[model samples]
Target: MQNIGKIVVVAAATLSLAACGQGAKTQAAAPAGPPVPPSSAAPAPQSKGRECAADDIKTTGKFGEKPTITIPDDCDPPKKLITKDLSEGTGNGAKAGQKLQMNYHLVTWSNKQVLDSSFDSKPFELNLGAGEVIPGWDQGLAGIKQGGRRLLIIPPDLAYGQGGRGIEPNETLVFVTDAVSVPAG
Candidate 1:
């Protein structure tokens, strides 16, 4: 039993050292502590952002259902990505380097128009923090729990910087995302 304990400690130390060596380029484990209350538990890791301003946008729907989002024509967005949970979920929290599946509704901030949505079709699947998706999603979706619905307002720098195939130049994107699942190991 003593030898087993020593091996466990050594393995944990090695993992900690490896994680530290990777720096900010790699995501770290959540801080160890007592359970965080639901109200304060879902903020994305390392995001320098605040809660959503109520008047900045509006949505009508329950979690697990498609939401109707409205962005007033004169609404001005913040420079950084902001997240707000419409409903808190119970499950393992999302993290970087995991394969995540989400149901998302996307809108263009300037026109207040929906650009694309996965509600009517298949859920979108992507490896979190991978370049397969835009940086906004890579950063905004971290730490979300399975079944949680998050509202994300992504600035131009995080979305498509200038323009992409279907997005406008310097577009500030708005998304309502549901963390459908993260496959278990």
Candidate 2:
């Protein structure tokens, strides 16, 4: 009788432990999917494939001003543009001078594979035309409005050139950039 009582207690304890382990596993797996949006019940769809020239990109907003030039046909078409308001500051609209803070998404021109992105965390800050960035950035950003979103299609000459930068040597580059903020004078 004593031995049987001990066996039953041990069995119950083992089952309790197994239940706890399963609970822990369920908790661990719950957060792996896409994060739930606060306002919407459904998660936003993740982008797939290369964001190509034919793709319709959209700009939802802008910070400062809008450019007047017609969107070049040769240039990659933007998904959207923020046309609601225009504001101004001390920074030059196109010239690269002080450091600019931007959120950028880069992809290979050939494959449209995303090479890097700074959308989730924070905007990237870099000095324009200071050789700190690729030649395409220095030149392509020349006439862009300060608070605008622009798509840059960079030929090899303006990008990695012959030697290429990492996997991008001599390859054409494509970038979608949001000029989030430029330093005020």
Candidate 3:
């Protein structure tokens, strides 16, 4: 019985030492430097745009139906023109290759909170005819005269599609925009 007890203790000790050695080897083999920060390993920034949150979207109506949009009172009203009515743009005013400057605020249709804007100081410029922006911008900005302010309710199909870049997928976008300038031909 004494010998058997001694053998059990020896086996336990050997197993413990083996575990300890492996643990030490693992510790030694691990990188000695400080842990890398998560930010350092993050994916590179993409320029498509930020995505919207899923909670920000609301599609109660049937597909292909344009949602109703209400412009806030603080939004500047559309202007009137003598030679041309600037209130509602002609929808054919802008052509490809022409640069346009405009102040815009984008919000979610469900909450009406401003998700993005370029209206703080200077207006944002874009080639109207080019396909540089979302389809809504290209189609919505077409034919709109300069100095006009319009409200555009862009559906997901026109705005971001299923997965909106930088925002949520299939989100409807609302924009109040003032067309500040349009380059002449």
TM-score per candidate, in order?
0.68, 0.49, 0.51
Q: Model 1: which residue pairs collide?
A: none
lDDT of each: 0.81, 0.58, 0.60
Q: Which ranges in model 3 have alpha carbons more than 4 Å from their true place?
A: 1-92
lDDT of 2 by residue, 116-159 (tens): 76775688887888988877787766545556677666666766
Better of 2 and 3 by lDDT: 3
- Per-residue alpha-carbon lDDT of model 1 for 1-185, expressed as tens digits? 99999999999999998877876444345555433447964443343344336456888777678888997644356788888888887677788899999999998876678899899997899999888899999999988888889998899899998778688666788999998986653
How are the candidates ranked when ordered by lDDT, highest leading?
Answer: 1, 3, 2
Candidate 2: give the clashing pairs. 57-79, 57-80, 58-79, 58-80, 59-80, 164-169
Question: What's the residue-level lDDT of 91 in candidate 1?
Answer: 75
Which candidate number has the best lDDT?
1
**Total clashing residue pairs per candidate?**
0, 6, 13
Once model 2 is optimally superposed onto the true structure by TM-score, how far is the C-alpha of residue 176 displaced, in angstroms?
0.6
**Predicted structure 3, TM vs. truth:** 0.51
